[model samples]
Target: MTTNTQNLSGQSILAGAATTGNGRAVHGYNPATNEPLEPAYSLIDLDQLKIATAAAAEAFESFRSLEPAKHADFLDAIAENIEAVGAELAARAMAETGLPEARLTGERGRTTGQLRLFAKVIRQGDQHGVRVDPALPDRAPLPRVDIRQRKIAVGPVAVFGASNFPLAFSTAGGDTASALAAGCPVIFKAHNAHPGTSEIVGRAISKAVADFGLHPGVFSLVYGPGATIGQALVADPVIKAVGFTGSRSGGTALMATAAARPEPIPVYAEMSSINPVIFFAGALSEDPAAQAKAYLGSVSGSSGQLCTAPGLVFVPTGAGGDAFAQAISSQAPNTAGQTMLTEGIYNSWIQGVEALGGQPGVELLGRGTEGAGQNAPAPAIYSSSVEQLLENPVLQDEIFGAASLVIRYDSAAELVTALSKLEGQLTATLQLTDADHETAAAVLPTLETKVGRILVNGWPTGVEVGHAMVHGGPFPATSDPQTTSVGTLAIERFLRPVAYQNFPNALLPRPIAKDNPWNLTRRIDGTLTTTGE
Candidate 1:
């Protein structure tokens, strides 16, 4: 693939129209070199932000009622459009995020792959969630009226781009893809760190909306101060829900704002998690050194910027644990740190690492070599006892970059007690052998409550985007644990079920009509049945 870098206007795209903002202008920066990129992006004010939301509300009406095939085709078109710009998109993302070309390219593939997956999902028609209860006029003293139910788009959605994933979690990313697949027009708030990348992807989505002859309001990408424009976008009456992926502070702020609205809406925000990795004695006994290296790979990958990076590792206290810690200490000095996503994130990582180090009972176990590039800091691993971990909340805080805490436990009881202290997380991995099943079983229930996904003998760095994958969890991990931010399940966030009763088939929507025009598999009288059945 070749770098294109051609038609980046650095303008806000509103309803298929390119418009420059009058608010403060910001430029994307190269974190690796500590230099600014070309074409400063102008931020939009509150009035201009309102225009995008209002247009999205308008687009939702027609978009929600689109034919299943056309809707599916629209999503497919977006994937194709993004793939067409794959080279340029990857290049811009690399320059802005300090991520390597291969990583950015893989992220771009994940983004487009998900879009195509959602296209298949919508075409399958099960997302409509059609259910019917037939009228029983001749049975019993009380006659039953026909009732039908199907999920509908919740209206316009406000998606905040994530700082870590400029391609897969920014403009035309999973949140935007899922919302559009659910038939909710999206108003994407471009991440300032990657404005040029946002514009390129945003244009791809805008092109799809136009090519499908859909309302221009189907998609809009705007640049603005997150404190002002971001909050206002969530508070807008037109936006029925929000999709956010960032810090705990940012997600909670949006949650508070949404709750304060006259009609409180759902905010599906993927916020904080220190995805924990547990090491059973048997698993680590084989080659504690190799296991330690694998753990570091997950910790330092992408400068530890991944949401699923193993922030907390539990090692059984004994010779094996000592060996593992010793291996980390010996190997870490040889490992080289990579460039972080941005300077702000790099600074935060430093502060968080320092705070953790300052806490009582915490000791540095290992520290990696610092990268030669700007904004790249050395990765560090710390050690603490389970008792200290349970007492100190600072030890559990996510450092967000190339840093992890290793907690040692003497017994299963102690380990379980410390595990209970953890907040909700996106994932938890149990590095256990067959002999360790009994111990794993004892802690399984507690793990179930604390995390959304559980893995055995693996790390949590790579998230597979598929039908069964869940990239969200309870509380601070996400506002709504019942929903997800990746895979086909993400569309559920932008949809709500509506039931129709005693309505004639002529007046019913196609998905729930007696004819089953969309040929969906619906539950009729509590049984799954296809059209013509």
Candidate 2:
């Protein structure tokens, strides 16, 4: 445990084997010490891309035909393999990302939990969306023909590893789990910031594929700079869909690339969000100190690197509001600074703070404890007027660090106006009391239009992985608001409906056959049941 015992092949994985490509070289880094880790990773070459994607296309034919139980077993095997890595995985991730062992351990659990949840979802047999309409020869005019419909996999997908949550959002993460559950193979691109961590997780997935005796092409992990292999994977004709989590520019660029292809595909990219939190007068007056403490904690956690961090907080302007601001100013300085995940991110956070502080009418309330590490960033709190935020669109952009912008408003109407000026967000939280029902009701519509999830007297930092969770939003928050990047529902994004007309029972998919071999719930002649009759 003292030495880094994690296996670092530093090679891209293709068709279940560790490989070295003929592209640019990349190395992982220890953000805490600003030192590079061992085992360099080579980018997947154009020839390798063709090989990996072709294998994926070849594997799809059999993978899509595998029974739901087999798919569930495969997913479960993957989770078990990941858990087998244990502390080695946590240690490597902590060193690479500068995240605490506890944080990485929790993220590891979330990753495995998501895979297991998708296993249960596939076992339920409802993802197929079976519908059958029997022919009615007794009808007047021409006889109606029998028709059936069911969902099918959308072919292979390209998944880009995220920089923040190396384990939960990278190789073998939610996108990969959901895609594999929907019967599509995945080609993962390792993030440069955490290549060592990606390699370890990728090895687990490769081992699971071998253990389950599934096709080797069912999963592959590629490495390189984001611009090189990333574009090649998306443009590969074999890849039918994409899953990404990164900056707005990066997401939009990928979307544009996918759109320009001869056969365009869906790109579910979670880009950016300045998840806003609104504070009601009653909640603040009830316990200002408690509210202030909670706010500081949420914004400062993980160096404020989370996508759902409360970047913007709305408060009422008055003596009570002044007291709340003063309380935050007093506590923020005491919150210790933490090392960021990457040097580039730390630089960006510094520049962002400068921009906000230099803006007209924006006042810096306080700064947190500073650290000596080159990649460390101190927490900061700032206050501004509603008019200033409305006039400066830049204020709405996320800082991607431990900083929160407080906008004080004189009236509820002003709060609504400020809300209207904001863009789409991943979440919107409202701190309200039972007596503030009317005001809560008034702001609900604005919140609904602006965010994917609405919170009642809750913080937006921690996202639950379940059946009802939505880790996505409109436009800037994600490319497609209709879909989410978390939970069992994410499987639907990689599936498409297919219908059969007048096909023989033997020719139809088992789930949609008139004989009902699979015993799945289906709409038969407009009635929902397990039996076709």
Give model 2's TM-score versus the native structure.
0.97
**Per-model lDDT:** 0.91, 0.88
List, residue by residue over 289-313, the lDDT tens digit for candidate 1. Answer: 9999999999999999998999999
Tens digits of per-residue lDDT for model 2, 353-389: 9998888999998788976676887898998999999
TM-scores for all candidates: the values are: 0.98, 0.97
Candidate 1 lDDT (Cα, whole model)?
0.91
Steric clash pairs (candidate 2): none
Error of 2 at 136 (Å): 2.5
Pick by TM-score: which candidate is best?
1
> What is the Cα-based lDDT of residue 19 in candidate 2?
88
TM-score of candidate 1 versus the correct structure, residues matched by position: 0.98
